[model samples]
Target: MLELQCAVRRDMLGLADGDSSAYVVPDSLPPRARLGIYRNTATGALLTALRLSYPAIRSLVGPEFFVGAARRFIEHCPPPSAWLDAYGATFPDFLARMPESASLAYLPDAARFEWAVNVVLHAPDAKPLDLGRLAELEPAELGHIRFAPHPAVQLIQSAFPVDAIWRAVLTRDDSALAAINLAEGPVWLCVRRTTSAVAIDRLAEGQWHFTAALLAGCPLHAALDQATDAAAHVWLATLLASGYFTEANLEGQVSNLPSGDPAT
Candidate 1:
């Protein structure tokens, strides 16, 4: 009987949406009263997590809309894990399909940008390559080198100038009125937590290409060759100064590259 009661409560809390009539243990009011409590608790926890994940989206749509959308979201896609961070992975897509809110074309992209920011904040940081280590590598040796960026580094490209939209919303003042053509080209964004704070920077076309190439594991020389501007070293220096790349693995059988430790 206790096992049966546990199952009923689990269903009530949405752990499993089973047949209500079949499972209704019509014994006493107190018997299933606890089940209702569990259900409310489960729903409340999910609502809070969703609100935290998409505060900007909440602000954009207002509280009533956010809660309504969240209820629908919980019903369709119950979180598969207890980890709150992993709970809202489907939220951006959910926003895209919200019937009443579908008019806001930019909403999905803005939510996606916010998700990227959240991802970056949790990623690990690392030290960038030093100049001396880079100088020691032979021309042929540049090909096999590998690099690892700080775990927090993320590249977000969106049709909307989402970074601008995000900034406007965050600043709470729409005073800086820059006309953004929603259909205009996508903005390539670099999101990372550097020395000061979590930052979002808009990448120029050339810089975007350069970063993309590097991210794709291209060797330094090849990445530079493919870059439009061709001033690869300058770009590399700029990024290094900005504390982007943390680990530089040189090519060839050499056990180690020169320590570019900014600490030294």
Candidate 2:
């Protein structure tokens, strides 16, 4: 029974030949024909999840091409989790490794952006840090301050113009998309969400690193040390105003919700 089950599973994933000799057919039906239906259905379901999760990729490649790529990806990277939303953790890497899209180099980064968007959307809610209270802290005590990034704060950086491409595809702005030069830039973006909607914006180098350090559990002053050419106080005020930090330095400890897997 175990051997038969293994064979069935392999056949279902198109890893083995679904020969008639391997199985008893009902009503003398053709084994290959029967197996083909199940195989196609399973592949289709997985493909649908990829298509939904990475709409920017689908739109850029076109449905036919994206489906072909997704099928190949699904064959190797089956979901480890039963939750479809939680699957495809490795899809951006899969796209990056594909030789066919070597010319469209930004494709991988665009996939990363879309994935980050989904993650931000699903992240749990947290109350904003009380800025008024923060202003009351003594300068000496503030130096050791550690900050918590909201659960939805996601940091994403790409060597290509991923942010522009993702935005164009999502908004269906064909002209904007056409005007995008993939070689124009390496973008650093912060993607965050609130009850109303998700927002994606480019960040300065210092800002990006500062947020990254904070999210990685660095203390406030230590994270500030990672910044470049910026007044830590003013910039930090902007980050707080933008709703990045949730809470800061409680009982001499600063803590925040996990900001999903880091996007590079």
Candidate 3:
């Protein structure tokens, strides 16, 4: 049964030619023709999943071009799991490598940004850090603290203004899209789910580095060292207030921080 399933999957994904002998055919329809129906349906569903996850990419490239590119991607890289929402995580990298997308240098980054939003939208929920407990720690203990970022938090760095491009494209603001300066340096963005909606906010380079280090499990002092600017503490405070982290640890011990007002 497992072998048959594997064979069917390979056939559906275009990884192998259909073996009509393996399928029970209707009297009127050829086995290969019946199999093609299933294959086409599966392909269409996968394409829809990609379109849902990458609406900006679709808008940027138009329906025809996006479909062509997406079909090629689906043929080469089928989803790894049953969860379609988790599919296409590597699509941004795929776009970067596609020869047809070479003219749109920011296309990959825009796809990446959209993927991050998709990830956060589907991420598991968790309680935000307790500000009251964090405030109780001694000043000396601050340097030894490490934080666990919320499950929905995602940090992205892009060479082009992908956020701006994503916004313009999705909103269909042609003037905003046209005014985008591709050479506008790099952008660091934080994509997180709020209580009611998803948010995409830009971060300063220093803040980006500091938050990245913390997300990587660095202790407070170590993360501060990675900050390129003098406002490391300010950045940390702002992030904490925004509910970026769920827990904080001091040294090797998990701090028993009670759930308090995150805004505090």
Using lDDT, give the best candidate's number. 3
- Candidate with top TM-score is 3
TM-score of each: 0.79, 0.80, 0.91
Q: Model 2 Cα RMSD, Å? A: 5.5
Q: Encode model 1's per-residue lDDT on 75-151: one tens digit a residue.
A: 88888767877678788999899888879989998999998888776666555556567667687876667665657
Clashes of 1: 2
Model 2 lDDT-worst window of ten: 255-264
Q: For residues 198-240, could you state the per-residue lDDT of candidate 3 as single tens digits?
A: 9989988888888899987799898887678798888788988
- Candidates sorted by TM-score, descending order? 3, 2, 1
TM-score (C-alpha, index-matched) for candidate 3: 0.91
Candidate 1 off by > 4 Å: 1-15, 18-32, 129-132, 177-185, 250-264
Off by over 4 Å in 3: 19-26, 135-139, 253-264
Q: Tell me the tens digit of each residue's lDDT in model 2 across 1-264.
A: 877776767777777786433575565567777777888887888888888889888989898889888888888887765588777768989988999888887788888888999889878877777776666578776767677768888999998878888888889999998998877867889898966888888987777887788777677777777678467668777887888876677335434222232221
lDDT of each: 0.75, 0.78, 0.88
In model 1, what are the clashing residue pairs, if there are any?
127-246, 130-260
Model 1 TM-score on a 0 to 1 scale: 0.79
Candidate 1 local lDDT, residue 220: 77
